[model samples]
Every structure is written in C-alpha cells, then in structure tokens.
Target: MATPRPFSRFEFLIAWRYLRARRAEGGVSVMTWISLIGIALGVMALIATLAVRAGFRAEFVDTILGANAHTTVYMAPQRIENEFTDDVYVVPGRFSDYEEIAARLAEVPGVTRTAAVVKGQVMASANDASNVAEVFGISRADLEAMPRIVDPATSYGELDRFDEGIAIGAGIARELGVGVGDRIRLIAPEGARTAFGVTPRVNAYEVTYVFSAGRYDIDRTRIYMPLAEAQSYFNREGVVDEIEVFVTDPERVDEWSFPLLAVAGEGAQVWNWRDASGSFLAALDMEDDVMFVILSVLVLIASMNITSGLIMLVKNKGRDIGILRTMGLTEGSVLRVFFLCGAFTGIIGTLAGVFLGVLLALNVENIMAALNALTGGGAWQPEVRGIYRLPAELRAYDILRAVGLSLALSFIVTIFPARRAARMNPVEALRYE
Candidate 1:
C-alpha cells in the first residue's frame, strides 16, 4: 500500500536536488560537470586499454596453440654414451609404440586429436640465403590443420609425396628469394661415421609450398616435411620423438593432461601447452597488471575532481546546512548527503564510460578498418604487426573491477570534505546572514 523510503533515498534526493539546481538556486556547480567528465574519460581509457591487452594475449596464444598440440607425450631424455668411441653421446630420445599411444590418447573422453610428430633443427639453404629452421615432419591432414603459415593458394602437391619436398615459411621464401618448385638443401647436424671420421648428413628437398602463420618469428624460422622423411633424415626410422595430443578445451590443460599421460604409459613424459609457453603467458599477465596500475592513476585523478566539486558545494550551501542541522538533522546525515552528491557523479560517469568502452572494444576491428579507409590505407598495417586487424576483447571482470576501483577511490576522496561540511558551526554559518 505504501513505499518505504530509506536514509539512502533521502540522501540521494538531496544530492539530485543539488545536482539539478541552477546557478541562482545554488545548485549544480561547474566543478561537478568537470569532475563527471574526468571520471568518464578515466574509466573509458582503462576499459579500452585492458580490452586491447587481453585481445593481444588471446590472439597470440591462439596462434601458437593452433599450429601446436595442447599436450605432448614424449620419451624422457636419457644419456647414451659409447665407451668404445669415447666422444659419442646421444641425449635426444625416441619412443617406439607411438601409434598405440596415439590410439589410446584418442580414446580419452576430452581428447580431440592425436598425432605422432618428428621435430628437428636443420640448416636450410636456398640460393645465397641460409637460415636455421625448425622442421616438423607431420602428416598431410595435420599439416592442413596448422595455421596456414603460407598462402593457401600456393600448391603443396609435393607434400603428399613421401620424402620428395618440404613446405617453408614465407620468411624463408623471402630471404632466399625462392618459391614453389625451388630446391632447398637441408643439412642435419647429426652425421654418419665414415672410414676416416664422422661426416655431416645432407639432403636436398624441393619446396612444394610456403606458409605464413602470421607470426614473424615462426613464419621465418619453421619448415614442414613428411613425418617419414623427418625420421629418415634424423636417422630415427620406425620411431617418433613424441605423440602430440589435442583436447576439446585447451584452457583446462591440467585436467586433460592426466588422462593423456595415463594413456601414454611409462617411459613417456608429458608436457602441456602451458609447460612450453608459461613464461610467455606470464610475461603478458605481468604487463596487463602493470598497465592496469598505470591507468588507474587516471581514475584517482578523476576522484580528486569529485573532491573539489563537493568542497565547493559545501561552501555554497553553508546556510542550508546550518538550517538543516538546526532542524534536528544529525551530522552523520549531513555527511551522507554530501558524500552521496559526489558518489552520484562517480557512479554516473563510470557507468557511461563502461558502456562506451564496451562499444569501442566490440567494434575495434571495424573501427580500424574505417580509419584505414578514411586515411587512404596504411592506418592499420597487418604487415607490421603480422595480424590482419586490430583485436579488442572485452571481459566483464575487467569492467567490473575498474568500476569498483573507481567507486572506492571516489567514495574515499569524498570523506575529508564531507566531514568538514558536517562539522560546521550552525551559529557561525547563519551569522553571516
């Protein structure tokens, strides 16, 4: 039948009255609008910056994990020394039953795909340019699944033929000034023993395709050859170095790793995506935290604007405050009234800013494209960044956290000024009249 009003309602009403009041009515001060704008801009900056940072990390991780497995099961490293040769030692281990292990991994509930991989480093020479490249020997199907590190239009027919050709990154192609049908020489560091001494193993492979994984480092330094070819080149026939496993959920590495590890059996050591890329992800996390801290200083500065506005309001409303205090209004209530006035600005500005920031984050790619169109291209360079467009990923947690921090700082900054207004002497305040 009736609506009950709380102290907060009364405080909000007074704060609203002050906010809408004209110059003649001693309402809405100029500083209040300034403070509101300040808070709005600060929150907007924080949200947009954090969103971009998050997108950068997500895109990078996706690119890396797309071409690689979520987890790798490999034979543990062991030392093999030859007493007769005195200088012969081998630390790189290979496991045999990889096909069985892969089958077992595929049977796991969360496992999506499994493959046995042969990886090695070799010196690649095309024309005058020679560079060290990470070579992966994988099946045709798996190679297609990898991030098209080169133009897909480029013919890769030779890749289907065992030991006939190799796929190189775009970087390798550029540096070597070579393309499809070019011949590249691969020299493995491991060698076979001859009558006199050990000789370096060498082979020439036709370049069947070129890929661009969109990562500059990978595009320039990686190569792909058939798994059989890799094994033959590496002198590990009928054996794979590791069984790579992919899971439905890459984020839950710990959960997926266990079942796959179980399926891999003994003599196999497992490493998840995080195990290989943890340091890189950790660095991104640290940078995100640092950016948050730095941007928060803007909000703190905006809160100071809130403090200034409230202090001015207090001086202008001295007589009103005195009259209210004389009418049995408590000092705590007076303090609340002013505090609510400042808090209202912080709340409104923060909400507005967050809304605007979300819109910006969601459409950042289109926005960049539009900018490029207007600026006659080159505004956003994919060639420079290796990404086709700008990335902006908005997270709800980041928005809420920024809003909370801004409100807390705004609330805290209001205290000193609100207290002074509450403690004013009624007699002295009205004596001026």
Candidate 2:
C-alpha cells in the first residue's frame, strides 16, 4: 500500500476556499465582520492591558528596590530597645551578633552584600525653616552599592564637604530652600525624659547629597547620612536599627532569608522587599487581578460573536453541507472543516493583536509623549509616574496562555454549529435548499 502524504492538499484547498470566500463577499456578513472585529478588539485589549500592568509592576518594584535593599533585618517589634522606644521599637543591643550574622549571611549563596543601617524620624531645620523627614544612616561605602542618586558628573558638594554630611530628598531640599553646603539641624526624640522636661536633642549637620528616587514619599521626605553619624545622633551605639541586605536573586529572597535568619539567631528578624512594601504590592496584585478579569470579559464577549457568526454560517451553508455529506464526507470531517474555519478566525485575530500589542508596548513611551504633546501637557512626564518609560516584558508564557485561551474559546464556539452541520441529513438539507 502506498504511504499517504502527510499534508492533505484537499484540506488546505477547502480551508483556503472558505477564507477567500469570506474575503470576496466584499467582506464577510455583518455578523462575521462583527465576530472578526470582536476578536481583534479582544486580543488588543488583553495585550495592551497586560503590557501596561507589566510596566507599572516593573516601575514600582524598581523604584522600591532601588530606594531600599532587597531585604532588611530589624529587631522584632516585640524586642524593640528602650532608647528607641519613643520613635522606634528599639531592639536590644545586638551589634556584635549582627556583625557576626551579617558575615555568615554574606557567605550564603545568592546574598550579595549586607550593611548596618540606622533609621529614625527627625525634624530637620535649616535656619528658621523646619520639615519632618525620615532619616536613614548608611555607610558611605555602601552608598555606592545602592543605586546612583544623581548623575555621576553632578558633584554632591554638599554631602562631600562635611564629615557628618547628609543627603536630603529633592522635595525636602526644595521645601527647605537649602542646598548642598547649607547647615541643617536634626532633632530626634530621645528615650530618656530629662528631669526638667522631655528633651529632644538637636544635632546640626550640613546637607551634602540630594537624591531623587522618583517616588513621592522617598523623594519628598527621605534623607541619608553616614551610619556612624546616625548612630551618634540617634544615641544608638553597639546597636543598629536595621541591617539591609542586597541579594543577587531578588525574586527568590525567601530562599536565602530563612537560612540567614537562622544564622542571625533569635534577636534579629528578616524582611524581604515585598514585606517592607506589602501594602503597595497588595495594591498592584489587586489591580492586576481586576484588570485581567475586566479585559477577559471583552474576550468572552468576542467569543459570543464567534458563536453567533459560526451559527449563521452553518445555516447559510446548508446546501453545501448537504452536498458534502452526500459526497461521502464523514460527519467528523465535516465538523473539522467548520472548526478549522472558526479556529482560523481566532488565530488570525490573535496574531494580529499580538503584533500590534508588542509594537505598542515597545513604543508606549513614545506614544505617551506624542499624546502629551498633542494635549499640550508638558507636565505629563513618565518620570512623574515613577517610571522613565513603559516597560513591556513579553513573556512566552503569557503569549502562549493568551493564544491557548483564544483558540479554546473559538473551539468551544464552533462546537454546536459544527455539530449541527455534521448532523444535517443530506435529504433534508438538500430538500430545504
């Protein structure tokens, strides 16, 4: 027996004929056009929404991770120290153990770098102007490990000029009307209440570096100082408030966190970036869920259009069905023909949408800028949104999922119509036509 050729020219011809017929009627029927449009629109919406969501996630995550370390170790709230009791839950002095733990953690696989950090809420005053800001103390050497604050060419003359220098947020700088080389006074609440009154000590330092993290909170109220200065000013010695850790694999922070915590022993606790920004992360997750659910409805509606269009096509092609059935085509083959037709519509629409979506995602920044220009909104900078530009990371999994969903919907929509066409009696269909 001769081997059957794998590619069936007949099936290809049949499919092509149907497709050409769809194009030649000056376009398909109103219903078919509606289905095609529906599919196109559905796909476009899915791609665009997912792309935007991805952009938002990346922007926010980068901003946060850049502003802080990938993970932090702090005294458990229950174990806060007496000195920091007023403003922060101070943990008992564990500086020695902290250093030891940090050393061990640094040895851990995937752990990049760890540094001691001190943080406090303080009132910053320059001359007569005062503003409340969160002050973070970090080692000057560690600052290099952090994301660059300002352009390398821009000298932080203010930060570099003094030994006990400070870096303030751009917003804070603007509010103070003070720049680098200006002296500022910092007041922190001490745990001790003086005999005369509650005395909050004030320490004066010069503003040195100004950083803009592009986050409203950070850019507005954050200040950075040398860890030693912070420890001295905050009256914390042989004890640091937190240990910030940078990790090589941020996504798998938990993998290193648990083991490192064990090495750090009972006094210290670990927090990943997600834990530090739980509320924001939750909001992002919720937004993604809501957007996906909402956009998926559009695909569902498009699927309905597929159903309606296929049903109509089945009715209109009754005579053709009858002839095909009479010509010895099996019911299964007949069903496959209609299924292929519906599947083709979905596949074409999905491909077109994917192309358009990727193109838009890649150039969303340009598109936004163009729109902003058209609207005369120079203030609509991408940086204002905390992202320099839209970031579209097209994942193969996402594309595969989308294509699979569309094809499944199309197949489901084709079922009843295909079944009806397949079951149509040759005599009845022929007689009716």
Candidate 3:
C-alpha cells in the first residue's frame, strides 16, 4: 500500500522539498519571498478596491430609493398656453383618478405600496438666500413611511403636528441658513390670473424636519409638504400629479412599472428609478471596470516575479533535476513539479491576501476612525471624501475571479522555466556535480 503512494506524491513531494531547502542548500531564495509578497499585495489591493466600489454603488442606490419611490406613475407632458408670459407652457399633466390608479397598482404582483403625490417647482426664500427647489406633496402616512436616512432631532415630529410644517433637504437648509423651527416662503408660478396682474401663490411654511438622504443634489433641491396643503397651494385640489409605487423587488422595477402603466392607460407615464439615474450609475460601473483592469496589471507584475524565481530554482537544482530524470521521472513530471512550486506561492499568497482584504473591507469605517483619532482627527476627513465612511461591499464572485486570475497567471508564467528544466541534458547537468 505504501509503495503505491509514491505515484500520488511524486510531483508535490519534489516541489515541497525544493521549497523547504535549508540555508546550507542555498536556503529559501530571496526571490521566492519577494514573489509571495508581491502577489499578496496585488491581490489585497484588487479585493479592497472592488469591495469599496461596490459599497459606494450600494449606498447610493439605497439612498436614492429611500428618498424617491421605486416607480412613479405620472401624466405625460403636455403643451399649453401660459397666461402670465404669453409663452408656450409645457407642463407635466395631472391625473385626477390617482386613487383608482393607486388601488390598481397595489394589486400588482410585485407592488407593495402606493401613494399619491403632487410635485412641482417653487421658489423658496429664507433670510440667507433664495433658491428654486423641487417640492413633493405627500400624505402624512406616506411621509412617515418614507425612510429618513438623515433625521432632524428638533423637528422630526413636527411634520405630523402642523399642517403648514415642511421637510426640507440639508443643502437647502444650509444654503438658506435655516433649521428646525425656522420659516421659509414658497412661491408657486401658476398663480391665479386676477385683475391684480396674476398673483403668484405665496405661502410661508415652518421648517419641521430636515432630511439629508446622503445625496447632495437631492439635499440641495427637495422640499416635502403635506399633500392637502400642497394640493391647495398648487391649485390642484382633488388631484395628484403622480402615484408613487413601492415594489417588493426594486431590481425588477419593470415588472412592477409596466402593470401600473397598463392600468393607467395611454395618458399615463411610468418612470422607474433607473431611468432617472442611469447615466450616473453607468459612470460608476465603468469606473469600477476600468479600475479592475488597471489593478490587474499589478497582479501581472507580481506573476513575473514568480517566473524569475522559478528560473532561478531550475538553475540552482540542475543536478537534482538530472538525478530525478535518471530515477524514472519523466519530463512531464519534472515540469509539473516546478509548476506546483510556483502555484504553492500564488495559492498561499492569494489566501492570505483574501483574508486580509475581507478584514479591511468589513472594518474600514473603524480603521478610518482610528486613523483620525490617532492623527488628532484631521488625517481622514469625511467632508473632503464626500462621504461619511469608506463603503466596502465584499462580493464572492469578485474575490473568486481575482484569485482565479492570479493563479492562472502564476501557473502560466512558471511554464517557460519549467520546460527549460524538463528538457535539460541529464548527462551534462550531473557532470559539473
């Protein structure tokens, strides 16, 4: 039974012995350790890079979906005459039967919830500045249900209590130098055409809550108000501009959106969240892809070290190779042995790198915090990074791909030196010894 085991251990045993050679036997080559370190660093960088990119994308998607609905059903744009300016006024038409549409959308397979909304653009003014902002008129119930990624401590509960209370984004609040309990003026463009030269509808709303939602654009330009007040203010009572639909699976937005569109018929326009942010998301994806390609070059450079180290190993063990060849070891076996030695280095390096990468990715926030604390809190700044913490999303597929790519390269690079050793003249190799 022990005699039969030699065949199974043949290549691996030789490779392991060569790797463990003592200092008297030329020791472990410095190049071998260098190759291992190189591979480890390259693999770690690739894993960490991919994880951080994924985290950023995931965080952005969640923030966007939380502030806005998964799918929105609104009226198609229509052209009309503007009495105020005698110009063509193209506007988003309103849907009067929003309740019916909401009810039908709720019955859709993937649809979980629906809320009617009145959305419009308005001019907002505070003590510090005046800016144009997008306004959402939502029911108290829907407002409560909408996720608040960033909450205002002083005014969080004020929205439900006051009819004229409004929630404004962080950017708007900052720009206006206003906070909870402050007042802002909202002016609607489509005011009644009275003999008094078309008075714009103006209303003062007390800032009730401030939401950040982790997005600067949304924070800069969004205000949420009660649906009833918004309907009255916008002069669209008993009608909502759109029905916002929440789905069970946001990834399958089309499945949820098409059914609502079909129920709402021809005058309806259904827009998924993807359509609104496709370009931004695409740019992020492309950046991740490009970064992956660039980082892979580091791994390729590390693989070259393996090639060099293997070439050195073959030269140093020329006599050993000749002895093995005379002892019934075929050229194929010799090649396999050298390949195994290099593969061992890659495998070990990759495993260590993966472990280190996962640890770093999972605790990046803590590490950054520690770094800041150690450096007196100025070394790592969130304001400069445009995000609060480093986001890391460890994906299994990405890790596996990185490891496979590194291993394949390591194996291929070993082939050249391995072949040279395998084809050596056994007689000449032993003559020097």
Query: Ten-residue segment with the worst summed lDDT in candidate 3?
Result: 148-157
Using TM-score as the measure, name the better of candidate 1 and candidate 3: 3
lDDT of each: 0.81, 0.73, 0.83
Query: Which candidate achieves the best TM-score against the true structure?
Result: 3
Q: Which scores greater on lDDT, model 1 or model 2?
A: 1
Name the runs in model 2 displaced over 4 angstroms.
Answer: 1-7, 21-28, 76-101, 126-129, 148-164, 191-198, 370-390
Give the better candidate number (1 or 2) by TM-score: 1
Global Cα RMSD, each model: 4.2, 4.7, 3.6
Give all TM-scores, in the order shown.
Answer: 0.83, 0.82, 0.88
Runs in model 1 lying further than 4 Å from the true structure: 1-4, 7-13, 20-28, 81-88, 147-164, 191-198, 256-262, 325-333, 359-390
lDDT of 3 by residue, 259-348 (tens): 788888888888989998889899999999999999899999998998888888888899999998898778888888888888888888
How much is 431 displaced in model 2, in angstroms?
2.2
Best by lDDT: 3
- Clashes in each model (backbone N, CA, C under 3 Å)? 5, 5, 0
Question: What ordering of candidates by TM-score runs from best to worst?
Answer: 3, 1, 2
Question: How much RMSD separates candidate 1 from the native structure?
Answer: 4.2
